[model samples]
Structure formats: structure tokens, C-alpha cells
Target: MNEKQLEQMKNGKGFIAALDQSGGSTPKALALYGVTEDQYSGEEEMFDLVHDMRTRIITAPAFDSEQIIGAILFEQTMDREIEGLYTADYLYEKKGVVPFLKVDNGLDAEENGVQKMKPIADLEDKLRRANERNIFGTKMRSVIKEPNEEGIKAVVEQQFELGRQIMNAGLVPIIEPEVDINSSNKEKCEEMLKEEILKHLNELNEDDRVMLKLTIPTVANTYTELIEHPNVVRVVALSGGYEIDEANRKLSENNGLIASFSRALTQDLNVNQTDEEFNNKMSATVNSIYQASIT
Candidate 1:
């Protein structure tokens, strides 16, 4: 789960936290975040992490069982074939986990960002098959689209179609607008987000469960724009490589904030640090957000 998903989960009684990456390195880093192999070890370590996180959130005073806890499985484009799809399948098999699949928007592609086709097609096919398999209670969410002016409309249309397919197959669709700090025009960025949400609303039913992803800087500005839209149900906050203090400040300002830390958590844990140092930072970060909602 990314920060936006975490924020959505936080708003409800149940909260979902996603483990960053899959494979050998990911588990070790997750261990630094206070997730021990003892608690989540073996062939089912990935599955165990999902279970443990859910249990912790459910036991927390802030969580409500009436609201469902959503857990997202994120896979980078390169890794999708190896372990990514397998992870999603495992989460779907587990009754308690709500799996959200994430695919990278090909911002790096040179040709109007349309050149990156395989991953998008693979993701769509995965969702289609998951539906065919009757994988109940699992949803699919795309990360924001690429940050390019010419490509924005095309990406939005493509994702909208993806969402429609997912919903038709009995899964929820999470709509995310691409946000890149390098973009020169802030207004253009906002316009792109609004346009995508508007398109989704116009095409889908008003009661559809659609969520939007935004960075902290845009939350205050865009929250009102989305609040009244019946199709929008959740708002997610993307950290965008901001410092912890900056990230926390933005989250505090927003009502529903999801904090995603992939590079930071992975880098910090990979370094040589005492267990105490690891535990302190990990617990502090996780607990601070958990505490923020209650107070």
C-alpha cells in the first residue's frame, strides 16, 4: 500500500499498511520497520505480513471492524512477472486481505509515454483473470499516470478503461493523477487531476468506489474539489521524496492522509543499524501516524 491507500484505510476504522517490494531484500528491510521474520517468515512470509499488519491495525483503538481494511500489493514494472502476480494471487486467496495491484506509469518512456505497453496490458489481463477466477474482495489500483502534458489525456482515458473493466469484474478501482515535482506548471498538474476525476465520474456510476491519489501540496487545494463528488470515496497523500517532517506536516493538514515510504524505509533498513535504532525510528513513525488520527 502507498501513502494514499494508507490514508484511506486510516479514515475508516480499519487501516491497511503495504509491505514495500517483494523478494529477499524487501523482507529484511521490512524487518527494520519492526516486522520480524518470526512474525512473518517462511514461504508464506508475504502473506503473513499482510495478516500481521491487519491484526495490529484492528487491535488498535482507532480502527473499526465495521469498515474493511484494504491492503495493497505494489509491483515495479520489471518485477511484475516474477513475484508480483504471485503475491497478488496469495493475497486474494486469503479472505482477510484486500489486494490492490499497482503499476508504474511510464513517465520515463520517450515516445509520448505510450511505448510502455507490456506492463499495462499485463496488469489489465491480471485483473480480468482475477475476476474470472472469482477472486472476491480484492481490488486493483494504479499508481498515478506519467507526468507529461501530451500524454495526460491518453493516460487518463486508458486508466479509466482499466477502472471500468475492474469494476465490471466486481473489484474496486482507485484513480490516481500523476504528480511530478519537476513539472513547471502547477495549474496544469491540477487541471490534469481534475480532468481525470471528472472523466471517471462522467463515465462511471455515481455510487462507484473510486479513490484519488494526491501529493501533500495539492491536498488542501484539491480536497474541496473532490469532496462533493459522489463517485470519489477516498483521498491518498503521496510523499514525493519529501523529508519526514515535511511529509508529516502535510499529512497533519489533511483529514485523510496515507503515508508511503518505499525508498526511505528500504534504504534506512539496508544500512547497518542496531536493532534498537531501527525499532525506535520505525515505531515512532508508524505510531505517530496511528496516534495522529485519535488525538
Candidate 2:
């Protein structure tokens, strides 16, 4: 682990930029960025287009360390370059932003009211390459749709188990067990999630720490204890499906949580915008999320 970036993460006041949308989510992400299905033909070309979008965002002036402390990259992005430097190096060296890699392949089919991550057949090799590429940490995700105790417990256990592997590989893990925003019993799901996370957090050794990326809870300050826990490096909130303004508002109400937004962060940007227009919109996006993070 890079001690400097770790310290920044422990105390940074800005939000994390979740630019890690994968193969499954790339089309929708591109669509919102004003690119349509007809824009790219095959999977390879689709990924190439999305990579171009990511490069544009990363190189924008407003996407700097001042208001965006960290960025999470997809594995493909990690293997790519930006302005003659590897993506992670470009982020930390040129932009002063810490970089993280999204390590999970994708989610499994829903079972027991939740969707766990699929088996990561190459997690070790991936982590090795991530470290070589100057990544500071990693993020992986699973989803919860109901408040079933057994289901939630399984989700948390799977997350922590992978988290330990990430830590042993010398990288912090952002353990995300996202509660579906549209779930019928969302509040109940969050309550159960909190309990499960706390149990695993308590079991960690003194030096073991991890980040949490959760869906913004129904109530303000719902994860206050998690934020204060010694084993938790930071608690970040995902936008789920909330619009930017609504996500920012909910984030501001939560005293210590910060945003790790994907869609909300890029919804205002379009593929056809001029560089000046894109940068201007990025400035506004960064400023709003930064304010909410600090509030």
C-alpha cells in the first residue's frame, strides 16, 4: 500500500469518482453520455468507446485531487494508458488522485434475496497487475434486494472474505454490498446490512481496515457507527439510481459519508460536447459533490 495515498483516503474531504462501470453496464453508461447502440458495433468496439469516455473524464481539468480524492477504474482501464502514462499513474501523478481497481467480474444470479459476486478466477493475477500499475486499492460489489437475514449474512461474509484476500495482497478493499434502492423493504435491508457489516468489522485485526461503499440509507447518519469504527477507513455512498441533486442532498444529510457516484457524476456530460463545455460541466459536478461530502 502507498502510505501517502492511504493517509489521504483516511482524511480526504472530497468524494471518490466511480468510473468503474464494466462490460455489463457500459452500454447504458454510454447511452447516458449521449452515445447510442449504433455508435459501436462489437464488444471490443464498445469497450474502446467507453475507454475513450473514461479518458475524457480523467483528463478533464476539473477531475483533480482537490475535489475528487480517488477514482475507481475497471480492469480494462487499468491496463490502458492516458497521455503516455498508465491510467493509475496518470491519476496519481498528474491529477493527484488516488486510484482503485474494480476487481469483481460481475454479479451472480439472484439467490436468497441477494446477488453475490461471481467467482473471480483471476483475482490474484489481477491484483498483482493492479499493484504493478500503481493502484492504491480495489472495489468489488454485490447487491441485496430484500431483508432476509440469511441472505444478507451470506453477502457480508462473501465480501469480507474477499476483502481479506485484497488486504493480504497489499491493497485496501471497498466492500460494497449495495441495497437495491427500489427494493420493497429498503430500510429493512439497510438495517440488516449494517448489523452484518458491524459483525465482520469487529472481527478484523487492529491494523486491518477497509472502505465501505453503501447505498445512501433511508435515514440521515444511518452509518454513523460504521464511519466511526476503527476498522473502517471511509464510508462512501453510491447513488444507486438517484438523480445527481437527490443523491447530493441525501449525501449532505449524512454527516460523515462521501459520494462514490458513477451515473450521477457523469449524467451531465455528453459525448458531443466541446472540451470547454465538458470541462465546465465537470467543474459543476465536482463542486456539488465536494460540497455535499464536506457538509
Candidate 3:
């Protein structure tokens, strides 16, 4: 939907729901949320979720469409394949749906990992298929190396090239500007983002649309920085490694901007928990974001 349409939906009670979970948990969480077997197996399940959510928003006066956004973060180690991501796009196509994709941002050298370019190419091919099948448009998000002056320039150049490839193939690229709350100075982080945005604007053509992600402590703060840059079509507020409720509250107040989340949705779902508990946590997180958007 156009921003005006989205605003209209938000004005009349809409909610954005985001699920921050590993790829392995996504199907189970959808099932726990009352996604029917037929819907789950068929191509329409994604749309069903969006359609059902829209109904809930319209019926609930306290919510708005802008309040609803859905997200999933796939861990690098997870065995879940690329099809899961395409399924997400299918969900996005339904009216009143916005989805964000998150990949792990390695902050420490031990945690840092790389996704091969080949996998990304495969993902693009799947995205093309999803579009051909009339699935929803989902945005892609990733974190590159942290920004030193030279590193930022190189990353921006590489991202611009990648963005061109993605747009050429007809998909939205959501690039995460590296922000290490633990290591990077806040003012320096903000400056890096500003420079990156300027770089993107200089490189992007008039027809190009780019979705950029940033990790910020609050929605209000992120919105203030992002609104200053016209090229930034969406800004996802990072959850700052907090609890889901704290994250949701911040995102609720700043619902107009795109939001990305991680950790909170996945912390409980490791090898230790039962599938049922994992599903519950996932559903709760998704519902929490949905409810927050309405507030």
C-alpha cells in the first residue's frame, strides 16, 4: 500500500505484527497462532495471516494498520532453507502487512560470520518467483562490517552495487548500517549513518527505493534521524537487546517507521526448550508487536 493508504489504515485501527524468531521456529509459531493446516500447506497461508490481522485491526478501534509490521530473523546456523523467506514475502503482499528480514550482525570476532554471495543470488531468484506468483513484497536486511571512515565508504559502495542487483531483479534491499551499542560511540554511529545515507542518495537513481535498518534505543530518536534523509524509505528501530515489552513500547510510539528485532524472540528457543514453549514465546512476540502498533 502507498503511505497514504497505510496512514488511512492506521487512522482507522490497524496493527503491525513482527515475529523475531529463528527460521526453524517460524512454521511452528504460525501454527500456534491458529494458522490452519490447509492455510499452512497452501500458498494462501501468508495472505490468510495478513487478512486475519487486518480484520482484527478493523474490528478493534484501538489499532491502526501502521501499527502492524511483521519480522523474522534467521540465524546463520539454522537449517531452514530459503523457501521460508519467500513465504514471508507472500505474507507481505496482503493488505496491511509489512515484513522485515534480519540476519545476525556479528559484533564480536567470534560471532562474526559471512553469508556467501551465491546464497544471496539464490535468494534473489526465489524472490523473483514469489513476485511472479503474486506474493507480497518483503524487505531484505543484513549487517555488514562496522563503520570506520574507510570501512564505511567501502561498505556503502558494495551495498550500492548489491542494491542495484536486487532492484534490477525486482526486490527491496534493506541494508543494516552497522551499530555496535557496546563498542561504537553513539555520536559517531549517528554520523556514520548520516554519511551512508548521503552516499546512498548520491548513488541511487530517481526510481530506486531503498530500505535501511538501524539499531537505536528508541523509536523517537531513530525517527528524528531518519526523517532528515529523503532517500530513506523506511527506518527500522532496533530493539537494543532488550525485553520484548520494552521494545514493543518503543516501536508502538514510532509505528510509522519500519522496525527490526532480534534476540528477544529467539533467546528462549534454543535446544533446551520444548517446541510448545518455543511456539508460545514466538506467538507472544508477534502478538506483542501487533498490539503495540495499535497503541
Top candidate by lDDT: 2
Off by over 4 Å in 3: 1-66, 70-124, 133-147, 217-225, 248-258, 265-295
lDDT of 3 by residue, 220-269 (tens): 55445554555555655566566777767766776454345554433443
The backbone clash count of each candidate, in order, is 8, 0, 15
**Deviation in angstroms for 243 in model 3?**
1.9
lDDT of each: 0.48, 0.95, 0.47
Better of 2 and 3 by TM-score: 2
* Model 2 lDDT per residue over 1-295, tens place: 8889999999987999999999889999999999999978999999999999999999999999899999999999999999999999999999999999999999999999999999998999999998899899999999999999989999999999999999999999999999999999999999899999999999999999899999999978889999999999999999999999999998999998999999999999999999999999999999999999997
Instruction: Score candidate 1 by lDDT.
Output: 0.48
Candidates in order, TM-scores: namely 0.61, 0.99, 0.57
Q: Which ten residues in a row have the lowest lDDT in candidate 3?
A: 109-118
| Candidate 1 C-alpha lDDT tens digits along 1-295 | 2344334443554333434344445565456546666664574656456334433332333322232345445443112321234444434343333446554333334345322222455666666655543332233223333445566665567667666766676666665544554445644566665766686577777655666655554545455566456666555555556665655565667554454433332334322455566555555555554443221
Candidate 2: stretches off by over 4 Å: none
lDDT of 3 at 152: 55
